[model samples]
Target: MDILDWIQNWFKSNCDGDWEHGDGIQITTLDNPGWDVEIDISKTSIASMNLDWILNENSKQDWYGVKIENQKFNAAGDSGKLIFLLGLFKEMIEKIENNTIG
Candidate 1:
């Protein structure tokens, strides 16, 4: 599936309570020519979840960022980065659900 489709499916499957009807996922262009993605996880069961992107020295274009809030998480990255970030987010949510993250 395409990245956008994957993202929408992921949110629909993993989140709860009419998430698909609202601004569950938001994407915008940054002035630095990057993409900023905001994902609302307020209704999900996971708590205190966080995801961060670390850039490898060999690759600057592939990176991600996550900002945790009381009701949402904001992710930002360059092109081709959202998919990776979303995967990371899924893992993090799983960990949170399993109570493995401290």
Candidate 2:
């Protein structure tokens, strides 16, 4: 499935009429010509999952970083790394769902 579609489904699945009120996903552009992504996971199935920060700095225009902090999934990357950033989140969720991680 498209990453956007999968992410949308994930967000929808977490909406319990209240979780969506004060907490949700946020995707914005950074001044450094990159993408910023934040998804609140405080009340979800994977809220307690532990994932250390993952970062890759291949070049000035090819870099990304992701981490779960303060009950939220956060990520940022160069202009071309948006998909990769989201892919990281997707992979993490899949791993947890498949019982491959805690």
Candidate 3:
């Protein structure tokens, strides 16, 4: 699977509708070639978390982040979601670097 395909699978696996529908995360492709990824997540209190990644050409990887809204729960709520996002992104990057996809 390529990076994009990997990402799609990762997100599909983690999708959960039971959680408090805070806000659906919106992912956008940056103007740059297909490497840049932008994430806009809605948090509580009408606030939002925005992140951008500039994937390295060599590693086929990048860094991204998000701030948990409300943050009533610990990482379980916020961290878990953020970590899942990062993990999926990392997994996708690795798949691309290794050229491993089904």
Candidate 4:
């Protein structure tokens, strides 16, 4: 499935009425010509999960970073990395689900 579709499903799955009311996903464009994504994981199965910050910097225009913090999944990268960043979130959830990450 497409990353955005998968993410939408994931978000919908977590929406138990109240959870979606005050907490949800946020995507924005950074002033530095990058994308920012934040998805709330509070009150969900991954609430207590931890993900150390991951950064990949190949060039001024090719870079991305991902991490979990304060019950939210955070990712930021160059404009070209928007989809890649979302894919990372999908992978993170899959790895954690498969017991491949601790």
Candidate 5:
């Protein structure tokens, strides 16, 4: 399957609480307040630079924000809902970047 399909499957049957899937993307609202997870996939090379998202100071080190194979690691924050989501997204992105999309 492609990245979007993989992401859809990932969240389709897995979530802490209520969730939503539409427009070819998956989203899970955190059980806690002020947090949420939005995941999507692209069918083009990561180098294409058309994902249409940005990473600011608060999101620079985010899972989907950071670029794969970048050696410069920056300390962002602690473990929690955001970090958990980050781990998931980062892993998925890495898979595609490394030509191991499955």
Candidate 6:
């Protein structure tokens, strides 16, 4: 499936309550000639955990232009940013499936 479709399906199956009820997940283009992906984790099972701690402790791989704040994560870069976001998203979904997120 396409990345967008896969993302929608993932949220549909894994997200609790109405996933689209708020600023849940946002994917948009950036003026810096790149893509941006924002994910709001506050509504997820990992809501209670520290966002910074989660990134530092779990995502060891470096994401240069990514930002995590208040249960939200935003990644922006060139065209490659899409791939990076996809990888991060997949890993998070796996963690969720494995009950690894607190």
Please name the candidate that would achieve the greatest lDDT relative to the true structure: 4
Give one digit per residue, the lDDT tens place, for model 2 in 2-72. Answer: 99999989988988999899759889999989999998879866887656788889988888988887889
Tens digit per residue, CA lDDT, model 5, 30-60:
3323234444333224433333333433442
Query: Ranking by lDDT, best first?
Result: 4, 2, 1, 6, 5, 3
State how far residue 81 of model 6 sits from its true place (Å): 2.4
RMSD of each: 3.7, 1.4, 12.4, 1.3, 12.6, 5.3
Q: By descending TM-score, how would the candidates be arranged?
A: 2, 4, 6, 1, 5, 3
Q: Using alpha carbons, what is the TM-score of model 5? A: 0.30
lDDT of 3 by residue, 1-102 (tens): 555566566456545763225423344343322222223222222233222333222322333333333422111112114445545545544564576843
Worst 10 residues of 6 by lDDT: 53-62
lDDT of 1: 0.67
**Candidate 2 lDDT trough over 10 residues, lowest sum:** 44-53
Per-model TM against the reference: 0.64, 0.90, 0.29, 0.90, 0.30, 0.65
Candidate 4: the clashing residue pairs are none
Q: Candidate 4: misplaced stretches above 4 Å? A: none
For residue 51, what is the lDDT in candidate 5? 30
- C-alpha RMSD of candidate 3: 12.4
Winner by TM-score between candidate 6 and candidate 2: 2
Model 1 misplaced regions, further than 4 Å: 1-6, 14-17, 47-63
In order of listing, the candidates' clash counts read 0, 0, 2, 0, 0, 0
Worst 10 residues of 3 by lDDT: 71-80
The per-residue C-alpha lDDT of model 4 at residue 56 equals 90
Error of 5 at 52 (Å): 23
Please list the C-alpha lDDT of all candidates, in the order they appear. 0.67, 0.87, 0.37, 0.87, 0.41, 0.66
Q: Between prediction 4 and prediction 5, which has the larger TM-score?
A: 4
Candidate 6 residue lDDT tens string, 40-66: 777666555444423322232333366
Q: Can you list the residue pairs that collide in candidate 5?
A: none
